[model samples]
Target: MAKVIVLNKEDFEKLSEDVSPEYPFLKDNREIMSASPGGLFRCLMVRAEGEKENMLIAQRKDTLYLGYGRDYRSFDLQGVPVEHIALEEPKAYQEHAVFYHRPSHISDLNGQNPLRPVPERQTCFQVEQVVVLSDEQFRQFQENGLKDDQIFLFDYSDKMWFDPGSFCWHCVLVKGENSRDGILVDAEGYSYARYAAFAPDCDKLRLQDVPVHYEYPARAPEQKKTRKRKEPER
Candidate 1:
């Protein structure tokens, strides 16, 4: 069993905006109503259960209704005690009401774990550039004495071969730098990496791109020799 953290409506509302900026779609959607703190709190409560399924809700006309999963557990929001009322399942409700699960690994609340307390200062990563490379190109990068440390971003999305569907982002700490780069890995093993260079000029190293790359590590001796030989005596 995991310990839960309860955030009140006020705190939840304040944090939701901060959270939105982290997501590209939400940041672009100006018309979308910002999620209420109560709603965000409820979502986090449900997420702590480690269940990635959509939560079920019973709406009472104009008033928004909240409920547990198919189990039909009832909950309250802003003094409104939600009651379970059955009606023809509306597709719009199904889509809009359903809150997607972000997975438990990244959602864990342990303070000791580096990845647990995400959305904190340490987890932040700036963006630099987005480099679209083929598998062979990536391999060549590896062969050319490029170390993973030199590259800020590494893909860990579900599309990749070894994703846990957590969508948790990680940072690569490079020496001689005050901060590290951020990397988001989805369940399918697909990855999006970001670096400090990606930070906007005006921002104090906050804003970041969906995916970016930084520097790679040093090359091996043989790799250095091969590069020297290929230099055409220049």
Candidate 2:
């Protein structure tokens, strides 16, 4: 998942007018989208993409919607929850959500939408098995022969989603053939170290999503890494 930047509705509407002027990179799209999710009460989701320095923009937007118990751009039980934003694969777009009021009554842990899955303390990507590439297993790719980087070693892990204030919800640990310290890669091949990963590089790395698994090894405790609720880097 990409970094989502939630913004107040009024503030979101004024993104091109106010925020874009200072940050000329965002000036390209002088159109503030009507990305309101369902256009329900106050919860809205605008598109944020095609720009560099997304991290810096998110940080700046946070300051705009700081107080009021995060009502301005925080809770949206009916719409895209923070879990979806925090725990998905790394991508270019960012969510500029605007919540008029926090859905304090709605269960943040349990989702109300039937189509979408609710992330609980149990939802995660658990490593069921690890395969060590054998010599005979190395001759699969066509034309290019077997390359070391082609080998994939996913470390045992669990990316259970935590509270709404988390960005490190789920990530698969990848150990490449030439890797020294190993790599923590998201579904989009974004490493924990923030190295850009092309899709082709991680084409063979397929990690399964296990909402809840007890047959595997011990799972990582919920909220251990996400307790602080930090945002992911761009």
The clash count of every prediction, one per candidate, is 29, 3
- Residues 1-234 of candidate 2 have per-residue lDDT tens digits of 112454444444455344422332232122321122333122122333322222222222223211122232343334433311211222332111111111211121124435433433232232223222222232121112212233232123233122344432233333333222212223223212121111222323333332322212223335645366678999
Model 2 CA RMSD to the hidden true structure, in angstroms: 19.8
Writing each residue's lDDT as its tens digit, candidate 1 over 136-202 gives 4443432341322322234422222311363223322121122232122212221222121111122
Question: Given candidate 1, what's the lDDT at residue 88?
Answer: 18
lDDT of 1 at 132: 32
Predicted structure 2, TM vs. truth:
0.17
**TM-score versus the correct structure, for each prediction:** 0.19, 0.17
